[model samples]
Target: MSRIFVIRHSIFAQIVVWAIITAATITFGLWVLTNATIQRTNRQALERAVGVDLAGMVDIYASGDKDELAKRIGDRLALQQRDGDVAHYLLADAQGARIAGDLIRWPGLHAGTSESADIYIDGTNRAFARSTQLAPNLRLLVAHEYRDLGLLLRQVALVFLTGGVLAMLAVALGGWTAAHRLAGRLERINAAFRQPDDAALEELARGSAGHDEIDELASHSGNALARLKRLAASHRATSDHVAHEMRTPLMHLDNRLVKALAATPDAETAARIADARTEIRGIIRMLESLLDIAASEARRGDRHGLAPVDLSALAARLGELYADSAEESGHVLQLDIEPEVTIDGEEMQLTRLITNLLDNAFKFVPPGGTVRLKLRKGPRLVVSDDGPGIPEDQRESIFEKFSRGKSCFGTEGAGLGLALCRAIAERHHLEIALAPTDGGASFTVTPEFQR
Candidate 1:
């Protein structure tokens, strides 16, 4: 599959293969056209020469001069072995007997029927034969050896074939080199945009001096990156200001509720005040979750300030830390973490992501149930709990901000645990997905494949 992808999709391979195919197609077309033209012209010349020679033979036999049929026969037979003498002749009697000729037998010879044919006197030589009846008892055959012309044509074909191959090779080499350079430039542009940081955008802007289509694309990308940075910063600031402004007032309201509860000795009024305080805390939790979600979303794919984290050791430590809580809740905690698993990521954010997932699992899992955490060499992290799994119908929606699954209904969370997990995964160039399980909820985390 990877090989097919390279051949079918990679820019360098595509261009080289396409160029070679086009070059070979044109080369073969020229060879066929040129060969046909040469064959047609040569055939016409041979027919004309044969017609003239037969006429000259008949005129000699009828001239009332010395019967020169045998003399012309002798003339050709003597010259048959010469390099320039490409003619073959035979003077045969009416009794179907050859008097003189190189051919052993006639090849469907007749009078006034001229067409091109490959008449082989032996195995190696080829000629076109023409014959006529001059005297009632005398018949003559004239054949022109075009073997030299055929040899020349073969040589020409060899030249065309070799030239075509060489031309295709040259095109492939040149196209591959050109495509390689072009692809590298394109990849640099893509990599810069992937991170969308100030340094990457600055580098992209600096490299646009070439002024080609690629450089033009880089220039546009740099502009987009700048705009993105500005927008993200603005949105982050606005969210922070709103959260701070609202939180201060909410805290003051909570204090007033506390004072009202203290002042009112009536049990019913105190219950109402406590309920208000609970609602206030819930609102605060929701606001904090929203802020975290916003920040993670804005930082998606940002590699700035990331450090290598030992994921295996981290998972182990987290698992050991949760063991006490699991024992207190009468639930089992299992860890199957691979050793030395590591990735480049924000450690605090990643810790929050894992903690959220584990906390979610522990919240839903019943007493005496098992919650398992596994980490593999792929940096794949999976946390599963033996509890009522999420309904398939609500799985997709559960990843939306403030959207909760059927199993999470009335749960203490702000319904943003899974959403925040997804956001944090995206920030670290990872993926978070709900995996199907027989009788439990299972969440898997791994590197995301863009394609």
Candidate 2:
């Protein structure tokens, strides 16, 4: 597996990314809502101030004192300047010209009408104001300038922007911390199974001290792997016991049959003894095949005691050894063994796998047939024989133990050849399948999930 795939596909990675996105979305939404609320409140406050001050101006106008109102405006302006406060005012005459205020000109043509208008200062409307006619010849206006409110809004925006950025950074840092820690621990668990050695499993054992879900998972997995190891050991011991108890008796019976054949000189009786010896030999071979199958099955998925084996050299050597037999049987044996086709495996078992397939090929293939042993760069091994092809019906069962229904030319076999071959292939994490062929049978061996 690629390291990139392992890291990027982690569940923690997805959670981390989603957390950061959600945090940013919420931060921006709250910032917009808060800014809008503050602006609304500030605008309402300015409107209230203008309304109250305008009402007071109406009281002054009702008193019917022109000098007093003018003096009040002058005093208010002086007080604002002294206190560094900003306010706009316009007390225009009925002729649409400034009379007693700092407004550069009358906002628009006016008379006894009382309404609202923009307070223009130096040719720019800077405030909203209300106007009223005071005794037909004078008008009063109290303006609410927006200069201070704008400065306050900008200050609020700067504070919000800075806080939002800090909040997002804090969220990202926390998410990254969580993702990195969780992903690193889970990756160690995955590595334990990929390589499956004691050193690899140490992380899982160490995780038992923690109280998180991953620790619980690690504890359970370690127990399960330990149990599997025990089961495999027991299975191997049983297989060895059966081989020992059965092979010795069978070998002794074969020796007795051989002696009987030698002592019995009568032609008819000697043939009978020889036939018995052949039966004993067949039984012994069957027992050995059964032992091989059991042993391979017991050790399936185990990587202990495995080492690099050169398939190219093994296949070439076997082909050379079988060359004379192919010539004697008048068959063509072709070897297309590419050099340096290597993989991690047990050399002895791989040898048995290749020889078993070749034995079956030689057994069923007639004279002048072609038997090919091919070893390719993918560590792909293929043994093909141009004999009578397997029937579609028998293809599924042929690899099963004692399935000799497809045994050609009445050949005698215990039918464990292909079954043993499959066991050996699976023991090494290789797949052996009867590949599609127009004639005869082709067995291909390749790694699972090759890419």
Candidate 3:
């Protein structure tokens, strides 16, 4: 019910409703004005007929006998009745005793007066009537029934009602069609924002030819996305340039430290030079990781040269490569790969992503602990270890670059491994999360399936 309310209150429904209301209101307004005009014209016609009849009867009473005058009035009434003119007449003494007419009694009224009212005659009917004292003891009343006018009014009402219904239907249909077109355009704009890729933005720009709110929004959004893409490319290029420029000097410094260590005669000075070389190597690795992170971020949603990558085969190869290292470290290594698991991605990036996760697992788990890799048919990849689990609070931040957990502060990892993995996972549209395990960390990667 709440969902229905939401839909009804939407712009499309509101447009349709307003159109129907406007059409109905216009239709009713015209109907009311026309009906009133027709009614007034009918009353005026009746008044004219009654006035002429009353004048003739007064002339007859002044010049002729009462009996003769009543006969003339009766004959005129009979002629109008036979012609279906809806007329009535009454002749009476001054004391109000009826002498002749269709009326049962004189409709009580002052002499020399004219008015429109509902009068009881053969039946109750609206009429324009007049009364006059033609002689000292003789009186006359003439009325014209407006029954046909009433019938005409009823017919007009019926026609107006039918027209109102048809108008409502026409307006509602037109309104809905227009609203549907507008809503479709808006939906296209929304879809562009969701995808936010070159192809989607181009599509949005192409659809924004119309001069409407949705079209304007599409135009604005496309511009914004293009700007963002350029900014991201510039940022990635800067990071790459910095990493490459620093690496050459850092490599030279490491080479000098190595030479100095070999030439030194003092054992303590040689050990200190070796420590400096080790720190230099760590710095080089950090620079390389930074370059990789930039590359991964820049490549997101990039479909160039993408192909179906066999995740199962890749995992198997990496498992074999890491097996010896895991065994030498006194840890049990396990692989449960589902056959023929494939995804559309860059094979090199996916390999790095998997390797980094596996390396992190191996680095954290203690001697005699277990590291297991699982690949399932859902294109789900899982790497788990029987090591200290990531703390609840640090699980989210653990994927951030250089954000190592407190427990692994002195561990071999510089914390770029998980961050790189996250970047690669986003590039492939995969959902990666740290699943809670009994006494260890469990990382699950579910690739977005192609339809």
Among all candidates shown, the one with the greatest TM-score: 1
Task: Output the lDDT of residue 252, model 2.
Answer: 88
Write the residue-wise lDDT of candidate 3 on 73-133 in tens digits.
6787666644366778888888888899877787778764544455766565566678887
**Once model 2 is optimally superposed onto the true structure by TM-score, how far is the C-alpha of residue 415 displaced, in angstroms?**
2.0
Ranking by TM-score: 1, 2, 3
Q: Model 1 over residues 131-190: C-alpha lDDT tens digits?
A: 877656667788887646668778889999999999998998899888888988888788
Which ten-residue region of model 2 has the weakest summed lDDT? 81-90
Give residue 375's error in model 1 in angstroms.
2.4
lDDT of each: 0.83, 0.79, 0.82
Once fitted onto the true fold, the runs of candidate 1 whose alpha carbons sit more than 4 angstroms away are 1-13, 28-45, 64-67, 82-85, 93-95, 112-116, 133-138, 148-188, 197-216, 253-274, 406-412
* Higher-scoring candidate on lDDT, 1 or 2: 1
Report the Cα lDDT for candidate 1: 0.83
Instruction: Report the Cα RMSD per candidate.
Output: 4.2, 7.0, 9.0
Q: Candidate 2 at 421: error in angstroms?
A: 1.9
In candidate 1, the residue pairs with backbone N, CA or C atoms under 3 Å apart (3 or more residues apart, or in different chains) clash, namely: none
TM-score, per-candidate, Cα-based = 0.81, 0.66, 0.56
lDDT of 2 by residue, 177-290 (tens): 988887777777776665566655655766756678988888677666666666877877887887778888878887887787778679988888788878877888898889
Better of 2 and 3 by lDDT: 3
